[model samples]
Target chain A: MSFLSVQNIKHSYFTKSTAVAALSDISLEVKEGEFVSFLGPSGCGKTTLLSIISGLIEPTEGRVLLEGQPISLADAKIGYMLQQDYLFPWKTIEENILLGLKLSKRLTEQSKSASLNLLRQIGLIGVETQLPKQLSGGMRQRVALVRTLATEPKLLMLDEPFSALDYQTKLKLEDLISATLKQFNKTAILVTHDISEAISMSDRVLLFSPGPGRLHKVFDIPDVIKNLTPFEARNHELFPEIFQTIWKELESFETFKK
Target chain B: MKPSKNNADLLHKQYVHSLKREKRKVRLYQLLIFLLFFTSWEFSSKMKAIDPLLFSSPSKIIDLLFSKLHDGTLMENLSVTLIETIVGFILGTLLGTLLAAILWWSPMVSKVLDPYLVILNAMPKVALGPILIVGLGPGYASIISMGVIISIIITTIVVYTAFREVDSNFLKVLRIFGASRFQCFWEAILPASFPTIISTLKVNVGLSWVGVIVGEFLVSSKGLGYMITYGFQVFDFTLVWLALLVIAVFATVMYQIVAFIERKIVKE
Candidate 1:
């Protein structure tokens, strides 16, 4: 049994006048410690698919599985980092990072220490007293990432987390995150439209079609950077080639939309 | 090239010069404008250009203030008025916050209560004085009930809107984490709405005071409002003016306290 599995999922939205089909007959598997990216054009429901897998939205058909059992919201073990950093502006940095822990249960002294250590590891030493508004954009996203990680979910779903960042900061965080995920040995699926980001960040990339989103193509890219961080993956020769291929997929999908 | 006392004098002169330069002339302007206003009123009253009894010179009002101060009853009545306002304001704010939490918990309850709350708020608080006096009796109870009626409604509307105005994304964040509804409220909604709620309290201080005074005017026998009414009936316009000024001063001070609390609680 694969560590994570999604099978024949279908979903739709009903407006007052029309039913919009977002996903159709989607099936995929993610093994332990593998990183996957969902690449698609705009309106392709990639985010919706991720949302469904996490059980934030109920899929209209089929099931998602963790270890071949039907995935429960409790058992799904996924942490989401959204496109925007939804940090509570009123909370201090330490409090913000501890949010998931606080909600789930009271953190023990050791666990709280570990969270502090994680914050230090994220290169934000002595910033615990600052509020979200005091931090730069990059720092806010870093705190957000740690908040998700603090939940200790087995599968991390990143919903275009770095898109809000500038180029330099994005590159820096990609390195920091990639290294952190490796050290922690996490399985992750990232939804992004950036071809280069997908190529640089994932072991496999699943490209989806727009609207009634279906898997258009899948690329096996483990060899691009065998056990290296996302920063190192950029230097691999195959990275650019994969980037071009995803770009073509997007172009064709747009044409299909038209 | 010895340093002389003249140099010390020059430094002192410069310091005084800078003090005068920095201290600003705005208060002087205000005092002058105020005196000018009353000067014209005094001049007009002397000339019989306007009715002396109606316009009432600043000097006459000052004399009235002194008389009331000497009597000590004005301050006692003022204290009574302030107590009603403050108690009512605190009660109203607490009730409003509680109601907001209830609404956040169950949207349907909020929806059902929505129209009724609007109607309740729209009803003139002054008109309720007779009914309140019948129910709660004719003193502080009626006065506080009056303030509570108006201020609680203000708080309810302000806090409810603030709670609803919180970014929907915060809700999604909690859901993604699989936080239960109550947990979501504790973790996200409460903290998010806290600032606005506190600011609403600051805003309602003045209104609540207005309510208390109006309540006192209708039925209170020992408050500043009561004194004002008594003064007006006895043709003591100066006493009435003194009462109004005292109420204004107390209300402003209470409003400032609310503002200070708001600054303390609101992070950004």
Candidate 2:
């Protein structure tokens, strides 16, 4: 059995007057410590898929299993980083980082010390006593990443986490996230629109087409891509070749309907 | 010094000198405006351009105020009204906030109560005085009740709307962490709505003061409102004008105090 399994998930939005399907027959299996990316255009239900896996949205027809057993919201071992850095503005940075621990009743002295160390690792040490508003955009996003990591979940879900960042900050954060995930040995599923981001960061990229999104193709990064940071992955000899191939596939998606 | 640095210092000095002169002129104009108003009124009354009996001059109002002060009538009545307003304000804020919380807790209840709260707020509070007097009698209870009735509905509406408008993304953050309903309210909802709550307090200050005075007009004999009623009955027009001036000053001070507290709480 895989570490995480999403089986034949179907979901729809039921407004008062109409039913709109969002996803159909979606299935994926992720191994322990492996990183996967869902690459798609907007409205492809990539975020909805992440939401289902994290137990935030219930799939109308399918189940998510962690280690071959169905996982529910009660067994909250799933960490999710949203598109926005949704840090509580009123809370101090330290208090925000410790929120999940406090909620789950696992906030011990040891966990807090570890969180502080994690803050330092993320280069957010001095802003612990300040509110989220006091930090710049990149710094606030880094603080959010720390807060998600402090919980120590089994599977991490990132929904367009770097989409709101500037190009420079996004590249830096991709590096930081890659390093942190490797250090923690975390299995992660990232949903993103940036094709290069998917190619650089994931073990396997699942491509989806919109209008009731379905997995259209899957690409595995070469073994040579291993152990290289996202930036290094960008510079690999095969990088351009692979990027062009996927770029063609995505472009074909836009032209196929016409 | 470099020539550029010398020029920069001269420019800074000129800017500061102009700013100081402008501020001085503004202050002088403020005093002059008040002086102009009072002097004209006093001059008009002395010349019989306006009758002092009907429209008391500033001097007559001041003299009446001094006599009321010496006799201790002004202070006693002023304090009585102030106490009533403050008590009513506190009670209304607390009860209104509590009701808003309860309503937020259950959408069904809030939906049912929505129309009723609106209607109550729209109803003229003056019309309820006789009914309130009949129920609570002619004392502080009735007066404070009047204040509470006037302020509570609006406070509840303002606070509840604030709670509803709290950013949904913040609540989603807590939900993803498996926060319970109570945790959601305590950590996200209440703190997010704090600025709105303070604004509601400012609005309540005016409403509560109006309530207390209106109640006194209907039934009290020792508060500032009672003094105004008495001045009218005995044809003491100077006493009426003096009491009104005192109420205006008192209300402005109270409003400033609330505003100061708001600044301290919302220090952004």
Q: What's the CA error at residue B95 for candidate 2, in Å?
A: 2.2
Instruction: Point out where model 2 deviates above 4 Å.
Output: B5-13
Q: Which stretches of candidate 1 lie over 4 Å from their true place?
A: A72-76, B1-25, B42-48
Q: Candidate 1: how many backbone clashes? A: 0
Clashing pairs in 2: none
Highest TM-score among the candidates is held by which one?
2
Q: How many backbone clashes does candidate 2 have?
A: 0
Give lDDT tens digits, candidate 2, residues B1-268: 6999999999999999999999999999999998999899999998999987878899889888888899998999999999999999989998999999999899999999989998998999768999999999999999999999888988899999999999887877788788988898999999988888888888888889889999999999989889888889999888888888888998889889989998998985
DockQ, computed on Cα atoms, for candidate 1: 0.46
lDDT at residue B231 of model 2 (Cα atoms)? 86
- Please compute the TM-score of chain B alone for each predicted structure, in the order given: 0.83, 0.93
Chain A of candidate 2 compared with the true chain A, TM-score = 0.97
Candidates' DockQ values?
0.46, 0.67
Q: Interface RMSD (C-alpha) of each candidate? A: 2.0, 1.4
lDDT of 1 by residue, B29-124 (tens): 888998898799779988889877666666788887777679887778878888888898889899988888897788999999999988988988
